[model samples]
Target: MRKKVLDVAEEAFQARGYHASSMGDLMATAGVTGGALHHHFATKKALALAVIEERVAAAVEETWIAPVRMAPSAREGVRSVFAAVAAELERQGFVRGCPLNNLAHELSLADPDFRIALAGIFSAWRQAIADKISADQRAGRELGTDPQRFAALAVASYSGAMSMAKTAQDASVLRDCLMGLEQGVMSSKAGTRRRSRILHRAL
Candidate 1:
């Protein structure tokens, strides 16, 4: 029952935005009475927090953490992560932007706890990408820029693209953004190799 409530809350939060969604809405959607909702989550804010946590966990698991766990190489896994997100957006017709991002934009200012929770999720996401970049470096894959910075940029760009796509109601914007990002990463890697070779020759 708790899990059902959380699941319903996640969908509602994603669709309606955090501030716009009420506990009553959640209760109605989840088919639970007020008493049952109170038994599980004492207040709307508490339920929102739970929804944020669940969305963060699910996003991390689906995008970065789980793919890395299953794939042969961290780099490939990271690619798969972004690809999966793009695929989802395409399938859903850009109706739902990222849940964590949407919630953060809506409720973070109103709720400090919400900001902190979302920040943790974003930090974990950036760190996972950075870890993948580090793994690529260890495997002799050249990344043209600082791995940590590039990782952060990639996550930011992807999220921003999703937001823009949702705003424009055009999925092609996301496709173009991701394609450009991938090309930039590749070009940067090439530049890094060229600089390395030149420095080695000078040495």
Candidate 2:
């Protein structure tokens, strides 16, 4: 029953902003009595916090963190995630935007708890990507770039692309953004390698 409420609530929050999803709407959608809803979550804010900590956090972990952490390289992981997400948006025939990102934009300024919860998830996501980049840098694949900044760029690119895609109702925007980002990363890496070789020979 708690799970049911959380599941439906997450869907509602994602589709509609937090402020717009009234308690009555959630109760009706979950088919739970007001008393029962309060029994699990004392307030709508509590429910939203639960969704952020449980559902939203898990979604980010599964969708971004795990793949980035386990992939062969940072660039490959990011590229694959972009490709997979673009494909998924196409298959779903709709771009509602990323759930975490959507909620963050709407609720980050609404409450301290909401801001903290959303920031934690974003931090973990960025850290996962940054860790991957740092690993690659150790192996000489990524050079002359701060791992954290690069990870932030990747996150920003995807988030902005999703927002644009949602507005355009086109998945191609995501693919197009990914292409440009990948080219930039590759170009910078190659330039770094050239400078390194030159310095090594001069020494």
Candidate 3:
């Protein structure tokens, strides 16, 4: 029952925005009575916190960690992460932006805890990318830029692009972002190879 309430709360927060979603709204959506809600979550903020935690866990699992684990190579896996996000946006017709981002934009100002929790999620995501890029670099896979900086930039750009796509109601913005990202990755690979050759010649 607690899990069910959290699930409904997450969807409600995503759809209605944190400020606009009330405890009453959550109870109605979850099909649980007021007693059950109060028993599990004493306050709306408590429920909201739970929702944020659950969302962060899910996003990490489904988007960041899962893709890297499933891909044949780290570089290819990073690209596929962007590709999967694009596919999801296209499928949803650009109606929904990222849930964590949405909450960050809407409720972070009001709740410091919310901000901290969401920031942790974002940091984890960025670190996941960085770790993958670093692995690829150590393995002699050419990624053109500094692995840490490139990973940070990629995650930032992807998030911003998703936001722009949602605002513009155009899935093409996401597609274009992915294309540009792909180009960046390719260029980085080339640069790595060039540097390797230069070092070889000097040796």
Candidate 4:
């Protein structure tokens, strides 16, 4: 029952803004009495927190973090993620945008607790990419740019790209934006290698 309520809560919150998704609507959709709902969640805020901490966090892990970590090359993994999402969105014939980002925009400023929980997810996401980039750099695969800075830029670029895609109702916008980012990163990598070769010859 708790899981069922949570599933319903996540969908409701995503489909409707936090304020728009009233408790009454949730109870009706979940087919639970108000007592049963409150027995599990205590309040709507508690329910939202749980959704953010659990559902949203898990989605980010599966959708973004896992892919970035799994690829043989960190930069390739990041680019593939962007390409895959854009392809899926185009196939679906709609643009739902990034789920974590959607809620971040809606609830980040709504409450301090919401902001903190959401920030924690973002931090974990950034850390994953930064760690991957650092490892790749150490391996001499992508010895360009600061890992933390690149991670920050990637997160922000994806968020902005998703927003643009949603507004334009075109998934290609995402591909375009992300591809530009990749070009910049690859240019830096090439430049760094060139400088390294020059210094090696001088030594």
Candidate 5:
């Protein structure tokens, strides 16, 4: 029953803003009594926090962290992850924006707890990307750019592209953004290699 309530609430909160999705709506959608809902989540805020910590955070881990961690190259991992997300957006007709970003935009300003929770998720995500970049740099796959900065750029660009796609109702925005980002990464890496070669030749 708890899981059911959470599932229903997560869908409701993601589709509608957290404030707009009332407990009555969630109870009706879940087909559970008010008592049952309270037994699971005493407050809507508690439910929202749970959704962020469990569902949204897990989604991020699966979609971004796990794939990048397992990939052979950070460049390929980042490119492939974005491409996959873009393809999924196209498959779904670009209706829903990112769930975490949706909640962040809606609730981050209204509540301090929500702000902290979303910031934690974003921090974890950024760290994962940064870790991948650092690994690639150590392996001589990426250029000399700061891993943290590159990770921040990748996350910011992806989030902005998602917002643009949702606004335009077109998935191509994601594809184009990712393609341009990947191209820039590859170009920067090449430039770094060229500079290294020049220095080596001068020695």
Candidate 6:
């Protein structure tokens, strides 16, 4: 029952801003009574936090971390990650932007707890990408690359693209951002390959 409430809340919060979504609203959507809601969550804030901790965090992990973890190359992994997500947004018609970012923009400024929760997710995401880039750098696959900077750039770029797509009601905004990112990464890789060829010829 707790999980069911949370599932309903997640959808509602994403569709309707958290501030606008009341417990009464959720009760109606979830088909639960007031007693049932209070039984699991003492307050609306508690329920919202749980939604962030569970549903939103899990989405980030599945969308970003898992893909990076399973990739054969960190560079290609990052590119493919963006590609896959952009394709998904396009398929969905870009009507819905990122849930985490949506909530962050809506609630981050109104409360400290919400800010902290969203910031933690962003930190974890940035670290995951940075770690992958660092590993590639160590392996000489991305020599001279600043992992931290690149990770920040990637996150910023994606977040900004999502916002633009949402505002324009066009998935093409995300697709363009993903394409630019992929081109930059592939170009860097190609430069590395050309350098290797030159070094080999010199030797």
Best by lDDT: 2
| Count of clashes in candidate 3 | 1
| Models sorted by lDDT, best on top | 2, 4, 5, 6, 3, 1
Query: What lDDT score goes with residue 61 in model 2?
Result: 91
Instruction: After the best TM-score superposition of candidate 3, give how far the Cα of residue 175 lies from its true spot, in angstroms.
Output: 1.7
Error of 1 at 51 (Å): 1.1
Return the top candidate by TM-score.
Answer: 2
lDDT of 6: 0.85
Residue-by-residue lDDT tens digits, candidate 5, 1-203? 88998899889888887999999999999999999889888999999999999999998899888888888876677778888998887777745888889999999999999999999999999999899988888877665777888788888888888888888888888778987887887788689889999999999
TM-scores vs. true structure, each candidate: 0.86, 0.93, 0.86, 0.92, 0.91, 0.87
- Residue 134 displacement (Å), model 1: 1.4
* Candidate 2 colliding pairs: none
Candidate 4 lDDT: 0.89
**1-203, model 1: which lDDT tens digit per residue?**
89999888888888887667788888898999999999999998898888778766677667676676577655566566667777776787654777767887888788789889888888887777677767777777644556678767777876787788778876666667767877887788788789899999999
Candidate 6 lDDT, 1-203, residue by residue in tens: 89999999999898887988999989998899999999999999999999999999999999887788778766676778777777777777656778889999998998999999999999998888889888877777667566887777788878888788888887677668877877886687688789989999999
- Ten contiguous residues minimizing lDDT sum, candidate 1: 73-82
- For residues 41-160, could you state the per-residue lDDT of candidate 4 as single tens digits? 999999999999999999989988999999887788789888988999899998877878888999999899999999999999999999999889888866667889889988888889
* Residues 1-203 of candidate 3: C-alpha lDDT, one tens digit per residue: 99999888888777778778888878888899999889999999888888788765687669867797667666677678777777777777645777877888887788799889888888787777778777776777644557677777777777788789778877677668877887876787688789999999999
Q: How far is candidate 1 from the true structure (C-alpha RMSD, Å)?
A: 2.3
Candidate 5 clash pair list = none
Cα deviation at 136, candidate 1, in Å, is 1.9
Task: Score each candidate by Cα lDDT.
Answer: 0.77, 0.92, 0.78, 0.89, 0.87, 0.85
Per-residue error for 189 in candidate 5, Å, reads 4.5
Full ranking by TM-score:
2, 4, 5, 6, 1, 3
Which residue runs of candidate 1 sit more than 4 Å off their true CA positions?
72-75, 143-145, 194-203
Superposition TM-score, candidate 3 onto the true structure: 0.86
lDDT of 2 by residue, 1-203 (tens): 99999999999999987889999999999999999999999999999999999999999999889998889999899999999999998999998999998999999999998999999999999999999999998998776777998899899999999999988999999899999898888788788889999999999
